[model samples]
Target: MWRVWLLLVTLLGAAGAQEGKVGPQKKPSPQNAPSGAPPGAKNPCESPVLDVTPKPPPTAVLDRESASNLARSMSRLLAHQQERSAQDRAGALAPSAAALAKKVIDENNGIHAVGVGLPQINLGLLHFRHHVVIFQNNNTAYLEHYWKALALSWNHTSGVWVPPFLECNPHSTEIWLHGFAIALTVEKQRAVAGIFRPLRLDQCDSMMAKLFGGPHRCDEETTKCVSEEGRGFRRAGYRCECRDGFYNPGAPPSWRGFPGEIVELDPNDVHRCTACPEQCNTCNSAGKCGVQRDPLVRGALLATQAACMLITVMMAAIVFKQRKCKTIASGMWTILETILLGTFLLYSTVVVRFFEPSVEQCLVEPWFRELGFVVCYGAIILKLYRHLIEFRTRKAHRWVVKDVDLLKYLLAMVVAVLCYLAAFTASSLNFIREQYKLVRTEETSSGQLFLACKPLWWDYVTEAGEMLILVFGIHLSYASRNAFTQFQERRFLCAAICVEAIVSGVFYVLRAFYVTTLHPDYMYLAYFVRSQLTSTVVILLIFTPKLWYQHKQVRSLAQEFSCRLPVDAFRAGEAGALTADGDVAELNLADMNPEDIRAELKRLYTQLEVLRNKTLRADNPHISKRRGGRKVAHRRFSLQKKGSREKVRRLVSLP
Candidate 1:
């Protein structure tokens, strides 16, 4: 090896010094030298027969004139190829890696570089990083691959480039395994560690390992790493083995320290395992743990939501049917309808959350759970406060807002809420935005990943709004608790809002503090409690009594209407209707949740107010220019001065 280098160095010096001329040759080191080979094995690095060692002379490589001509010819070749045909007019074709590597080995006197190098060398025609083996006469090299083309960065020097070393013929039958292919059935990219050849897997493992104390591991992603007690070759108490039905095709003797270790060259370097082929699942390496979801839990939620929605719809229908009753429609029946809608929306949130928290589900979730509260509870609080005002103003003997006036106030409040929600949704509901999403997913350490749709950071916005409503409702409920207009309705309203506040507070607290450590409580109990609060509190406590009272009073009231009782006679006849004796002893307000007679006046007032005059024409009827207006209200009833007032007194007296 030294004799060959001496001859090349002499030629390079002589040719570089003067005008292209041969120089005086140096004496050879000896007849025989260490060629980095076994005592009897033939060194594939050198040609067996060629006198010139089968390569262009080093002097020709150094010749400046020859290099200039080579550059010009390369340019002309590119131009000529471009002009060959329109089929390749887009651009010149790229040379395949096999052709480039074969040319490299042929030019280097058949010397082959080791498995690994800096890939940058493959960029130019001067040298390459990968190994290329050419067997018999063939168009392509038998093997051309970059196993572990690596790089070195200078620690001390400011700027330096490390040149690669051509260590040995990587494909030499005695040295390396070549052209081994790994087959994968499931995961495609996990074709393992045999990819790095000259790199020695141990060195790479040490570089990337963060373990403080442990056996250096093989790549688990691509190989089946396991503990072992016996060590051999480069393995640290463990050996690399090909899976059954898969064998090392071109491995060095004894499979690089398998059960029978025959490590002839570079025995200390780590030997990596190669996969069998792409079509084989025999070597399937699974690194991920199995994940499972509990179908029973999700099914429970789905059933609960479906049941609640049905009950809410049925109750809403009953309320609409009983809308004509004064107690049922007290303080605007529209408010009850709005509350039902909001409660229905709240129930629907569970259905929206039935799926995993995807972009679409997360988007719809906020509208159902958050804005639904705004619509439902917003109506409740406003109605409670309106009741508070009505009670006070009635005690003061003053006229206050009518149903339409109250509705307009509700519209204003809703519009403001809509504005705030609109701004929030537009800015926050961007499909990808993390904030403003209603529910977020979390995972467990047991490889069981479950999405809770749990409370997020943005839930505070909606929560805060709900808190304000509940607080306002509490205050309104307390102030109106003693009102006499709607018997027991004030008490029922107070109970409903208080129950809501309690359930919401408890649900949120559990979700915040203990739900993660104790889940399915949040999924089952917490969600059920919060979602069904309206059904229990508002529907049962507030509306059920009203419906029952309407059912009881309807029969009696219908008989009175048929008899055409005068207004004054009906108002004065509560004693006769209740009992034979003119006494209040028989009527128990607490037990009966008795219907309020004065509420009948308010119901009549609403009826007359619908045909009221415009503000500017306060003394006259507010008639429209349309061809047909509410004149049916005129022809069927007297519109004479004080006629509407006299009519209302007559209707209210019937209660």
Candidate 2:
């Protein structure tokens, strides 16, 4: 059985070798396989060996499809990369263009670009790029030549080449950039070596011919050369000095060829110049320049000064002439003088300084002017008090009284004080409280506040008070015109009372209504004008010669009346006329002789003695011997025939 099995295994191994080469299920021979091997290739337990064909390599069509899919993926990646590259290029260019624009703006300071048409050049390329290709087109030549001509012209006129820098261009950026680069190069060359020695006119003409491809022909009459009109290209004019207020547009051309060949031109010389008007100039010469100064302005100033001087001198003269006229009215005049002087000084300062008043300054100026009003009015108040006292006491002759209307005077004084206080309060309240808050919050200063808070109201009040005082004083003056005599005194008193009533009514209306018509402070000019007018009225009323003459006539009449009575009695030869007049008249005993006066006095004494005795008897009626006393008288006569008749009459009446 072993021989048979060995023989079978040998045959099966031979078969497996054949199957391994030709079938898919074949396994490697025992020599090729490692470790454990099947015990026998022809084992009955093993499945039967099957012959299977080997798989073929993939076809060319499948290979072609795979290659196509891979190629499509690669194409998508390349397209994405190209898009990213384009975006990057645009981003980089945008910033570069902006930077170039900013650089041009900075170079030109703040001048705005009116037109632009150019791509910005990258300045950084010069550093990294190994080589640069400078393209020279016809545009470059045109720009270079034009700029050169302008530079030459500028140099000829101003004695310095006005270097051109980057400016807005309507063409392409490349053209402008190239043009500016050339200009910058020329400027740099000038800075290093100074400009090529100024070229003579002939040399400049030759250079222009070469650049413009034509010879330049200058017009002898017009002084302009052949060039395009209405464009920047223009020929240089003859070298000339510019007139006042004018300047040459360019440098002067250098002298060359013929000596003194260059002509001089005046830049400001008018084309058909006419002389300034004679009124404007002092010069009478036909061709001479006239003075431009305004004579009217000077005349106005001079006139103002003259007027001020006249007023001042007149005031001084008045003051000097009326020094002794210290009447209440005269005091007002003095106050007026002071006011005029102060105002003159203030106005003079303003005129000299040419100050223009703002609202605040206006207000303050009035306040300053009002100081005079207060002082003048205060003096008038005092004067009024004196007049009032003189009238009341019948002491009109006493021009100066030690004591006057104390109460009214005190009230006036109080009002004056209140006026000042109110002024101070108003000014302070307006400025410190109202304006100060506004100023502080707004961070402003006091320049205007000082002006706005001017004491106009204070001045108005002062003027009003002064007016009142004047009226009262005038009334008192009228009333006291004949205080020394009863009849004239009564007349004056009545007249004064009437005047006072009228004045009071007028003043009341003015003070209560007119003054309240507007804010007193705001209407300073009006107030000043009104006050002056009122003063004028008062002065006219008080100083009228007619009124003064009438007063004098009344006084004279009173004096005549008082003297006439005594003179009449004396003329009639009436005795005791002097004595009856009063003690004052008796004190004047010089009119009578001592002896005649003594005799007259003695006779008068004897008569007085008799009259005194008769008066004593007349008091006793019982001594008359009436009928009612008859029985008593008979009894008394019988009983005492002796006892006494006188005693009997009295005794009988008693019984």
The candidate that achieves the highest TM-score relative to the unseen native structure: 1
Cα TM-score per model: 0.42, 0.25
Per-residue error for 276 in candidate 2, Å, reads: 35
lDDT of 1: 0.47
Best candidate (score: lDDT): 1
Q: 432-544 in candidate 1: lDDT tens per residue? A: 36564445545444433345655555677778778788998899888877667565777777787888888888777766765554444346545666677754567677678
Please write out the lDDT profile of model 2 over residues 207-229, one tens digit for every residue.
33321223333333323232322
TM-score of model 2 relative to the true fold? 0.25
Candidate 1, residue 503: the lDDT equals: 84
User: Which residue window of length 10 is worst by lDDT in model 1?
Assistant: 185-194
